[model samples]
Target chain A: MTTSIHTLDTPVAVVDVARMNRNIQRMQQRADSLGVRLRPHVKTTKCAQVVEAQIQAGAQGVTVSTLKEAQAFFTQGVTDILYAVAMAPNKLAHALDLRRAGCALIIVTDSVAGARAIVEFGRAHDERFEVFIEIDSDHHRSGVRSDDPLLGDIAKMIHEGGAVLKGVMTHAGESYKLNTLEALQEIAELERSECVKAAEAIRAAGIPCPEVSVGSTPTALSAVHLEGVTELRAGVYVFFDLVMHNVGVCALDDLALSVLTTVIGHQPDKGWIITDSGWMAMSRDRGTQAQQCDFGYGLVCDSNGTLIDGLLLRSANQEHGVASFEEGMSVDVEKLYPIGTQLRVLPNHACATGAQYPAYEALQPNGEMAHWSRVNGW
Target chain B: MTTSIHTLDTPVAVVDVARMNRNIQRMQQRADSLGVRLRPHVKTTKCAQVVEAQIQAGAQGVTVSTLKEAQAFFTQGVTDILYAVAMAPNKLAHALDLRRAGCALIIVTDSVAGARAIVEFGRAHDERFEVFIEIDSDHHRSGVRSDDPLLGDIAKMIHEGGAVLKGVMTHAGESYKLNTLEALQEIAELERSECVKAAEAIRAAGIPCPEVSVGSTPTALSAVHLEGVTELRAGVYVFFDLVMHNVGVCALDDLALSVLTTVIGHQPDKGWIITDSGWMAMSRDRGTQAQQCDFGYGLVCDSNGTLIDGLLLRSANQEHGVASFEEGMSVDVEKLYPIGTQLRVLPNHACATGAQYPAYEALQPNGEMAHWSRVNGW
Candidate 1:
């Protein structure tokens, strides 16, 4: 049931559906066993077809990074969505629209100004929107300090404004920067504790808090205990990338998505094999900058999905990818992959690479191909 | 004439139409003065509107990174399109589709297999496709060596395959690696010499060679002489990015496209300003990896398009951008930019960043906004 190249176009993003289902089931099982709800983040695929698979795998709700995603998924019949980013006033109308459309919309905010903006917007619209106060767990990225006076003030303001203060949410985003799984687990525990503390502060301030959310692919996958986290929101787990593998979050084999390309030329003298898939196809996501190993842009795979022994897309231009084999690794670039030979490249960041193309050519376990379009932009 | 936020969404890509028009005119003037055909590469924007603008500014033909781009522009009445990439068999049909639809299509190949594949596809389909033998210049990314023995053999084969061997093409992509304009000029000269030599070899082998092409934004913009280049193909000049500025191809003021985002929150004590524009909005293109100065992700701008002093997006998550103001350069984040305040962010690589979104919100010089969609995928 393998689709012929003639029917499909080159440099189109293709996802192995069988592999993706397996990946989703595995993550769902892990969350179920841990007594935690898995809220699969839709930011990775931005495809309704993929989100349907996640929902089928027992995902409690979905997390989105943009209002456009919430609007798209809400239209597609998936109502519960957590807009994982801080809600801005300009985007309030879109959020309110989703809320009015029967979506259990949850928006995150960290500052007093943010809380006020949401309150003002919610008041004007006469909408009671669910709100999550973002807590700074490791001081890695954006968040309100867990014990900061601002956190209590924001929670109190949200409660007074008639909006439901769901609880606190924090992401151990810097867990990806850890060198070991132990470090990731430690970061996870810290994130959980910080979130719990933020929730407790809001409660102590006479505000009702329902859930404490904490997430990061590395931390969630490695965390020993989900002490306070009622829901986990991790996106990259569905299509593990090189950065995930480098951080000990997943193995290279766990990567379900790949960029299928064709070798178009070669510089035998320089040991470079040129491919039609360049940065435009594979994406410019060099996720190895903070990792232990740099596999150039990505791991090169044969047409059959087997990792090539030494080949690497070391450099790329707009429309040209240059493959460099390891110093003495034996791989016949000239014969093994002729000019028309098809190959797949596992990307450094699946989400970034996936977003570059418009649609995905889904491949089933039986090798059947189905075209699925991905939604983009806000 | 200013359009309200409700008219166009925040965190949307905006291209200053007036600046882009000026950029097109300037580049066309440079090419006209140099007495060379300007085949402006459409890879930067991938928008037919931008391509139409380029053509209107005197671009004789256009260069495309993918067959999909060629198809889109051709459908928009752009007849002459150079598929400025090594042509693979998988994409031959789509390239032929463009040709059959009355497009003056030209593709490039460097390997015997590439030449033979294009020839075989042409023969099987009974179609003719123009081709240029891609020559490896200073950039070792792709293409056959200028003096490879297979060069002459491949050229002869392409000429006899019912397809015209236009000549040769080379790109000094490494010109972006230069630190000074003088170095870029040297790389430009080297690129021109390589293309000329490849064409000379094909001519010496008794093949009809009519065109020699060479291009790279840095090379095309800095080259003082164009001795052998019949056509110049350069992208990224229309919307200069951080990479272009670092490479001395353009200045900071030359950047025409930017992501318009809203400041959603602030971590005042930490000097962190959070914006709705994250990697998903700004793209994960850190093109300054090779440059001495790392502007984090990109330069930050006020709502009025003025570059913020010493403030840069220091870190980014999937949907969150964290800006850090250099020590001693402090501005009240909340005061200057409240929760609803709009800001613009100049991207690292315009092409990669621009591709994340579906369309451009074209901003006129006087601040009016119009929408234009960009084509994606192959």
Candidate 2:
């Protein structure tokens, strides 16, 4: 007997399982065609079942943004984990603990101070830590410029200071801002070439640097070739969102994650239908606002996961969302959607929206349902 | 013996217990002077310890935004609970269950359909649910206007249909948009008079209205008197944030919640000091963006909680924050905040930031520390 999603609580996270599996298979196929290993970033879902599904689809290892994610996935028996964010000195002991627990945990460093701290911690703990030097291809966030002299210095520090210099990795996060395939491909190539150059720079310094990693959801889907990159990493493609759709990467129906909310009341004068899901359920992610179309918190959908064009969740309080037409008055809102009317909202960013819920109610193609719990706080 | 906050994991929520207690006492005292019961909204910090502290400081009851919060706090012995959001029909069973369990759970409704659902559900289940008629004082979100004809109909529907019409409640949520004391006072008065007017209308319809409730953090602290209001409700005051600071309701030092983060690297060329606390940690609130002084994501502070002027967390990725001066170049960025330099970030909105964490590392003024866990998902 399959449980029905209609009977579950409102303001709950709902994942279309068949769509999620299709997304997983597509990313794996893309990586395979590009001649690179796929290391899916688990930060988006952080669910063991989702990660297992990716692994089953031929994804090797995993990328995490937090030590807690690393620890959680490691406890679930997926040993190959890469802590992708630049390593902080304070987290060295936690990394050491994970490494000692027989997990192949690889850490990243980008600055001289970071490399020194990792090396010092490794020496003090009598452990050789595997390290990757983060490369700045897009100048989006953390990382060292590929051609900067500090690149060689940081690489040498990790190599000479009793740590294994695994290689270089870069994420073209700025690719999310681009809507055209040409721009995405350009950023993807820059990401690949810059990261490969950094690896070569370290090799020229007499250190055997293996592995070149590069990707972001946009770049991964748009890259013409992987070339020197040994592996590709991407998050959010596991459950596409409105931002991805606006960026021209995914179709609207491909959005696998949505918040299932129930209309609680209405303001006929204002043409507003209030829903139980607000910023607390949808998350305060306005990622699509900068795109061509601004879906004010999210795009509204009918109860059966079909898009209801022209309506948007225009505003939100902690527990109340106001849904209305994008342009004019939504006449007959009360009669159209009365109290207890269930609706779905596609998020602007899956990673942010998925973080709000403790577990997602996965709806299978055959109408079966399953609960998938995710990692919460660090 | 006490543990230093520095020893805790990076990106952990830190609550100043002394400041929180003072905030609680101040609100309770204000309610006492106003001749009203204080029903502190527990949505900002869903921690039982914080609620217990508020109750000890003379708060009469607690207000929650979600039923899960109601359930969690009810399990902790909080009997008089108000689920503040407008009631959805699908949740009637859960509300009935809570009422049957000897808990004084008060639900809210603002429309005829909402009232009809509650009345029908109560009659079907052989339960007489206590309910509040929600009044829209500021047109901020959900509620019926005091002069709206629907207000009387909704109240009559609940009272005449085998359910208890407890009273009327309203929230002056737009008070947060005002920075001047005069405007805040004006909104506060409007909140009180409108809610009381709605209650009087209900009484005119032969229903015995016993209570009138109103408040918001800015309005609660700025109101000279809350006449005709039986209780005041305000969230985000217990752990005042940057938005409240800009709203002129709380001093910066009165902010009790902060995210403790560590400098992982730096972009010296861009004068960016990278920290581990990103949007995922501090939340994508940006509540102060439209305020007088826009704190990008948040205001930067020293590890000891001293505000570092001119610096703001300008941008954030999923797991990396870029902190820099608001205007000119921040020379010696690496020297000023080297790798591993711990810093605290005051959040833009306490309710949003607190929702991102599972537990808070509460620090006592006497150097003692405790872990306070909070409710996460609905």
Query: Backbone clashes per model, in order?
Result: 0, 0
Query: Model 1: per-residue lDDT, tens digit, A178-254?
Result: 86877887898998889999888888878889899888788888888887679988898888889889988787888
DockQ of each: 0.80, 0.89
lDDT of 1 by residue, B54-139 (tens): 98888988988877788888889888889888887777777888788899999888877788888888999898778988888985
For candidate 2, write residues B1-378 as lDDT tens digits: 488887988898999999999999999989999999999999999999999999999998899988889999999999999999999988888888888888899999999999999999899999999999999999888899999888888888998999999989999889989999999889988998899888888888889999898989999998888778899998889999999999998999999999999999899888899999999999989889889988888888999999988888988988999999866654688998898999999999999999999999999889787999989888
Best by lDDT: 2
Q: Score candidate 2 by TM-score against the native.
A: 0.99
Q: Clashing residue pairs, candidate 2?
A: none
TM-score of candidate 1's A chain against the true A chain: 0.97
TM-score of chain B of each: 0.97, 0.98
